[model samples]
Target: AATEAALKDVGPIDLLVNNAACTKLQPFLEVTADQFDLLFNVNVKAVLHVSQMVAGGMKTRGSGGSIVNVSSQASQRALRDHTVYCSTKGALDMLTKVMALELGPHQIRVNSVNPTVVMTKMGRLGWSDPEKAQTMKSRIPLGRFAEEEDVVNSILFLLSEKSSMINGVALPVDGGHLAC
Candidate 1:
């Protein structure tokens, strides 16, 4: 309800961006159910709740709108330490497709942007140590991490009319990391 109320000030929402995330890296045996629920609630449930709120207006308008969810390469490419994170994003990726199909008739487009190792502030914290950074860098086929601009361009494309017919898809902003 708070999420919806916050959007009330924005009036009608033409674009909805679901970009929340949480991660806990631990050995399979070390993970607690509580940790799992925390990530799921923040990463998944919150997205649905917000999307539904804005989507109603989009549907009623009967013209069109766009929903862009930020998923991750982890959704498809498994990292050794990312068990719960991968599962949560995988669910997000699936939700994008399901929502796309269900909302297509309303001209409400639903899609996802899946990035690999982006060098966002939070992302860099995970490998602030030079040795860890190098190790992480080696895994990216592009030989470098993703810049914010790289992701912004993809997102702008997806949000713009250029991607009018694109839906139910997970477009990779990964610089071909999955290919490597």
Candidate 2:
């Protein structure tokens, strides 16, 4: 695969960001087996595979590395019509914790960022309904959804030396959504 080939060419990877994800918003009863499989394959399996590859290289190099998985607030909060997506993210959060525990001895830190509804193009369309947006915003103490920069900054901090001692943390950039 292209990713494997690139890793091979570059040799040991010092930092890895597993950000690949996919989702389908549908009622739990309406989610088909195939839909579940696709979401799991992309969101969960891909992160496992990529992290294994890079972490192996990092271990071989005998140098510590940082891995940040971009998860979602849905992992912690139950959202309607997002059963499979929420499950995938929840699995990812657990994976981050386990990876951190196992890799800590090797000095490889693993963490995740749980961001609330970000105002990206997809987010704009997803929350286009003012009623829905307001309803969701009311729960956030910040009185707003997350910005792309907010998520990026959190991720960068987790990946940088600044978070060298931090591991197994699911940092939330959710404007206090988790508090509610």
Candidate 3:
């Protein structure tokens, strides 16, 4: 409702960034139905809902737009204890591709950014253990986890005219983590 009201007040939207997500870190065998539901609801369903709403307006306006889904490296790589989170992100990546294919005619481009551990508040706390941090960083050729700026820059590129030709791509901002 808030999003609908905002659209009414602000008029047609040219860009939609689906960045909402949730996670529950537990062994795959230990994950419960409720936990999986919660993660999927926030990480996948919310993006689908919001994008449908925004894309409708963009379509009607015929002005085309960009949709950037903030995914994670987990979408492309398996990680222990992140089964639910990883699954949701993988779903999101596929959704991005389908949306791109379906909406391309209307000039809507959809893409996702898959970043490794970013040093945000949550990221810092999650990987604060020196041993774990080092282990993760060693995997990245750049020898460091992503900074918020790195992800932001990639998003800006995808949303800007600079990336007009780019669509349905799960671009990694992981400092070469995916390369390895």
What would the per-residue lDDT of candidate 1 be over residues 133-157, giving only the tens digit for each residue? 7776787777787887887788888
List model 2 lDDT by residue over 89-160, tens digit each: 999999999999999999999999999999887678778899999999999999999999998889999999
Q: Which regions in candidate 2 have their CA more than 4 angstroms from the true location?
A: none
Q: What is the C-alpha RMSD of each candidate to the true structure, in Å?
A: 1.3, 1.2, 1.2
* Local distance difference test, each candidate: 0.86, 0.92, 0.92
Enumerate residue pairs that collide in model 3: none
Instruction: Summing lDDT over every window of 10 consecutive residues in candidate 3, give the lowest-scoring window.
Output: 2-11
Per-prediction TM-score = 0.94, 0.95, 0.96
Model 1 lowest lDDT segment of ten: 120-129
Rank order (by lDDT, best first): 3, 2, 1
Give the true-structure RMSD of model 1: 1.3
Model 1 spans with C-alpha error above 4 angstroms: none
